[model samples]
Target: MNLALAAAALAGTPNDSHGESISQGVDSKHILVSQAQDWVAEDRQLQKSTIEVAPSDRRLIIPVCNTAFEFNYPFASSQKTLRAVCPSSGWQIFLGISVHQSDNALRYTGNFKAGHQLTGTDVELASLSSAIAGLAGDLRAIEGFSLASAVRAGDLVMQRQLVTPIEGYRLNRAVAAGEIVESSSIDSILIASATLSAGQTVTLEQLDGARAARDLAAGKVLSSYDIKKRHQVLITQSGIPRGHPVTRANIALQDYYGKLPNDSLQNYRSAEQMQAIRNLAAGTMLRLSDLTPIDIIRKGDNVQLSVRAGALEITVTMLALENARLEQRVLLLNPESGEEIQAIATAVGQARGLSTVAR
Candidate 1:
């Protein structure tokens, strides 16, 4: 994945009382391949020869990740204008909902270097106020929000009131080291296709340091003229059938000050029920997730699931798919039958009229 296309690799543990449970997950994370019959289209920067299976040929469809959505985050016209921008668009969100110690800290890094340097500390309040308000508004809506930056310190901090009346969310995590930990522009988002080299390695590009700054130095934070980033990732495996992971990765980028960009950012997901009807009617391509599995009744008879929205709209549909893995022994009856047929499964969806769904 090019930096422009995808990003995120989770890490960090929320320092709190429940920290024990927060630090580790029941299972360590590892990349797995899936979809043996299908071909693999190596996504981003991952090379695969494996497949990842959703425990039950299904996984709980939790709302996660966002991409094009960030592209829509309405650009804020410098902070001075004081326009009450609510961060309604453009800015994308990487919901590090994982309370796991290794997944709590949100990381943000892009191309921007210390925002357009100002002539004086007094600059304009309107723009800064707008930025603060915009920043604060976003904090209020998202839970446990933290502001990371390369320049915030002392007086440059974002107070709770600036974010929301809600008491819980705030920039509480202090930087233990450098400048990159706090600033939005200092964080880095990467995308690529790579083979397995290390087993879940945590690469700390910058040492830890002071958290977000509320103050500033004379020089601007450095940045390349053209930089790209992202928070959502799609890992596709290589080899036989290959597999794809619809997941959110955990990652963070800290600058010289240990500061990361803004963490008050948010990501969104449309519920299954909501997308199904449209897909069924206009032939919309509903998320594969929305399809719930029904019981298998008979041979040739399809397994059924519902495409629904809320409790009101539900469309029952057929889902027939074949899945088989090579068992130890071969088929006995067919004497002449060759080695064992590892996997076999038929897939039948309500594809009859689903073609029109593609955008």
Candidate 2:
């Protein structure tokens, strides 16, 4: 049988975790060939070979050696002679080796534009014997990732060729301190900021200290610019009434551009489900200390009331007589009885009160 082919067939045979043969090395020649296969680089594989092992040599026990046994190459680059060395026993055997080029590679099935995200459909397996430098061997690693560079049909997809999508806010133009960054001058850039040739991501903290180091031109990619620390202020989109829940609808984010007092919402999520402590006019810049969380019950607002008595729990609708936050005492008016009672604000528009008959 062909030596390299014999080695491949025997090498693939299932073995235990420690690589002990399930067949107990019953086929000694095959086991010896399989041992030589391990020396080949992952990128290369043995093809065909002529191995000569003496009948007397086959019976000799070789102790495991920590160093690798050298395989001698005697012929052209495609063919070799592998010699297994037993350093402890001082024994050596020469085996004629023949090898063919092998490659685990990826080939593009179709053309893709630069900056395009690579999909599974764009790639397919290449021939195993066709080795290409820098080619990717695993499809799972590259699929769904974007290519760092473009590729043509039949082009090789290599490691480090794909990138993860970047998502964040990018500045469209530069600004001086205390100047409000206009909407037209900034946008969300999904590409990585490090590779960005034109934009810089603006964080809420950056808004506090951020400013153009000097005059910056429009269409300038932000990644290269330096920004001082700053707080991105939330601007009132519309006039916000006192006690009104602050939402995205009524507020917009803005970066400080000039020398101004530091005041703004640091987190975009903070605006969600929050209420204004006082009335804010349209376009008013917001500060972290300016707004409070929404009150659970508000004055003149309709609220659901839960009354607990022993095992009986009753739910009734009532009007709030005063504004209150969670767990705060608030006065609730019974619309039908025209009487007010004390209740604890529990949740938004929800309150808990003691059961009482109308007085």
Task: For candidate 1, give the lDDT of residue 12.
Answer: 36
Question: How big is the RMSD of model 2?
Answer: 15.8
What TM-score would every model get versus the actual structure? 0.15, 0.33
Task: Name the top lDDT candidate.
Answer: 2
Give lDDT tens digits, candidate 2, residues 39-158.
544225334332332323343333334445555444445444556664444545656544444466788998886556667888887776555666688789875577677779998787
Tens digit of per-residue lDDT, candidate 1, span 256-347: 22222342212223221111111222212223443222221223334333333556644333323332111211111111332222112222
Q: What lDDT would each prediction earn against the true structure?
A: 0.23, 0.63
Candidate 1: residue 194 Cα off by (Å): 41
How many residue pairs clash in model 2? 26
At residue 200, give the lDDT of candidate 2: 52
> In TM-score terms, which candidate is top?
2
